[model samples]
Target: MRSRRVLFAVHDWGLGHATRCLVLIRALVERGDEVTVLMAPSPGLQLLKAELGQQCTFYPYPDIPKPLGRSPPMFYAAMTGALPLIWARFKREHRLTERLVRKHRFERVITDSRLGVWSRTAPSYCIFHSLRQIVPGRSPAIERLVERGQRRLLKPYRKVLIPDFAENGGLSGDLGHDPQLDWGAGRLVYIGPLSGVRRQNVPEDIDYFFSLSGLEPQRSLLEQRVQAALPRLSGRIVVARGRLDAAGDQEQKGNATIYGYLDRHAQAEMLNRARLVFTRSGYTTLMELAELGKRALLVPTPGQSEQEYLAQFHHERGHAWSTTQRRLDIVRDLARAQGTTGIPQHATADSVQRFLDAIS
Candidate 1:
């Protein structure tokens, strides 16, 4: 195979995008491709730097302002209000992408949910899981409208690679699977779950593994709530705060061991050893849980419709127990989650190869 110069753009909305991209970027490097990552200044970027080291080039780029609100209604309103600004950012991103493509002579451009990071001169592709954005009300009309809009935004890419199985409705369920949407046959590909974490043969010593992550005040809020309830719970607990800036510091509080962050290897080991996993319902996290077949208590972030939908979907299916952040009772939920079945393990060993083959 010829060594190609590839430019990968990642969305800084959360660490999930960066982590999943890391899997593909590593595969590209292993195959002798020169890869460059374009991203905003974020913890996600820091994590990539720490993991990849000198393996790839890193470019700093500005990202659109995150649309966040304290409540679900406010969040939707904020997204609606930020449309113009988001559009401007998209234009800016495209301009930067074009300049980078010309200057670096990139042979391929792949974006992970960054709508504006594609180049006309290169063979561009997009990695996206959500084909239809579910709203707070689950209105069919609203969902269809949003799906149409998303399809239009994805029209410029040569292919939209979905990191999910083609059969059994996949992990994403209705979020990525919609019979109504027309994606121009052969342009949409299901490449299975692109997770960096894998199950390992290790003793299940950790009673509860809290992998806390997300943006801003909500992350802090969840931490505070968990801290308040920690004294009431018993057993060997491990909490990864998901703070990349902490530089991997560890602290001990009673029976629980807390870390500011856990790199890929450490996190994978913890997941394998944990008898019960407690974390968010983000798609990426769900994929990891599915890969490891770990039972979990899911707490969805406030105002995040997608997470809310996913949590409910899993709970109804008896895959994982879920609750809102405001109503979190760690002790009670943990007990309840133990009785439910965990996510089923799926074959993801060839997911990265499938992606590479599709692009090639």
Candidate 2:
């Protein structure tokens, strides 16, 4: 087969979207295909660039505004208010993708939860895990409507690639495969967990690793909390602050070594050395931990029902321990989180090859 030009549009929700996109992006580049990435300026995209180097072309693109608020109700309210902007964003990106497609002659367009970046001339695939949008409260009617809309919006793509198993034994739990959603046949493909971290035989040395990520004021708030508790904590802990824009600086603060950001290899190396990891319960983070077989303390972001549900799911399944950011006491929670089982290795090299085959 001839080498094809591929366009990858990533959603800058968190670093997870870009991190997951790396697996496929690297695969395309390794196969001698021209891969161009369109993403907003964020830590995740920065990490992607550092990882890929000159293998792919990077372009800045517009991103959807995150619905952030102090509480779940407030987040929902903000999201409702931003519906017009969201609509306009979709239209804007749709037009942008059309222009890019015409200029670059992209043979395939793969989007990581970007609903608008698709072209009729090229085969387009959307990478998504959430089929049903979770609201703060239990509102079945609203959830059904949201799910219907999600299905409708994704129908234009050639296929929807889920980073979870089609069977019930998936990492995404009910979000990817619930009984309520009607995902049409052949339109959905389970590509398994897309993670850039590969398990190594390196020895474990670091006692605790704190991976700080997600949107902020919460990100900053969590950093403050962890900083306060760091002096009391007894361990050789390394904290990756998840600040991509900042200088790659490391500082010693009592028993903790804090880094503004870690490149992919460094992050993987730290994960390998860590006996216990502390981070958000994002699906990509879960995949990374699972790949390394490392235990973690999951602190779900407030008001984000998806992360909350995922934390709860893993906690109940003995995969990982979880707590909300408000109730999190670093020293106390570490003891509780240490006793739980970590995520198991479910994804393999075959999964990656299968994903490449399907996309090709």
Candidate 3:
């Protein structure tokens, strides 16, 4: 088989999409394909660059502006207000994608939740977990409209690759498996969970590990909460402040250590060594936790219905513990988190290799 030139684009919503693509990117590079990443100069993209290094090329790409607000209600309101801007950005992304395809002459295009980044010149694929985009309130008409719009947006892609299991009811609950928003058979490829974290057979020395990420004011709000709670918690605490653009700085205060960011290896090691962890309930983080067999206290980003649902879904299933930012009683919740079984670590090496083969 001959090597193909691949162009990959990721949405800059949060670090999850970009981090999850690391698995695919590494696989493509290791297979001797020329891979080029089209992403904004965001923290997630920066982290990707550091991880991929010389294995792939990078290009500055356009991204939609983040919906901003201090709280959940405000966030939803801001998202509603930004609809026109988001639509305009989508159009711009289409033009930019076309231009990149012409210039780079890519043989394949893979987008992680970036709707407009596909091309007719290449075999384009969209890798996303969400089929039904859940909002705060449920409206039959709104749901139908969302489904229809999603279907139209995905039409340019060769296939929508869901990074989840087809069997075992999937990892993403209703987000990935919803009969109402079905995209028909043969349209989706269940690629299992794509995660880059490698587990180590090490002793669990750290009592608590806080993996902080996402767009802020929420991120900042969580940071403040964690900082306040740190004094009350005992044993070694490690905080990986997911700031990719910042320097790799570390600060040690007695039993607690905070780092600006951790590479894939450091993250894996820290997560593996921790007895209990605290992190956002992002899909990628959940996948990583499952892959490593670690349990966490999940605080879903406010207004993000998907994350909120995931947090509750896992909690109900005894997979993990969850609490809102406003009601985060750290000491009490950590004790509660200790008892819940984590999301089952079921992703095998065979499934991962099959995922690579599908793209190849």
Tell me the lDDT of candidate 2. Answer: 0.85
Model 3 lDDT tens row, 1-360: 688889999887777778788877887888788999989887778878888898889988768877878787888899889989988988888888888889988889999988878888888999978877776676777867877788888988888888887865677986787647667667788878877776788999999999998787788788888888888888999998877655488998677899988877888899999998899999988888888878889999888878898898888888899998889899999999999887778564645686676776
lDDT of each: 0.89, 0.85, 0.84
Best by TM-score: 1
TM-score of 3: 0.94
Better of 2 and 3 by lDDT: 2
Off by more than 4 A, model 2: none
RMSD list, candidates in order: 1.5, 1.8, 1.9
Q: Order the candidate numbers by TM-score, best to worst.
A: 1, 2, 3
Highest lDDT: give the candidate number: 1
What's the TM-score of each model vs. the native?
0.96, 0.94, 0.94
Tell me the tens digit of each residue's lDDT in model 1 across 33-52: 99999999987898899999
Itemize residue pairs with steric clashes in candidate 2: none
For candidate 1, the lDDT comes to 0.89
Mind giving the per-residue lDDT tens digits that candidate 2 earns over 1-360?
789999999998887888788888887888889999999987778878888899999988879888888777887789889999998998899899989999999999999988889998899999889888776575898888888999988988988888887775588887888737777878788878877788778878889999998777788889998989888989799999988766579899887899998877888899989999999998888888878877889998887888999999889988888999999989998989889888877664656786787888
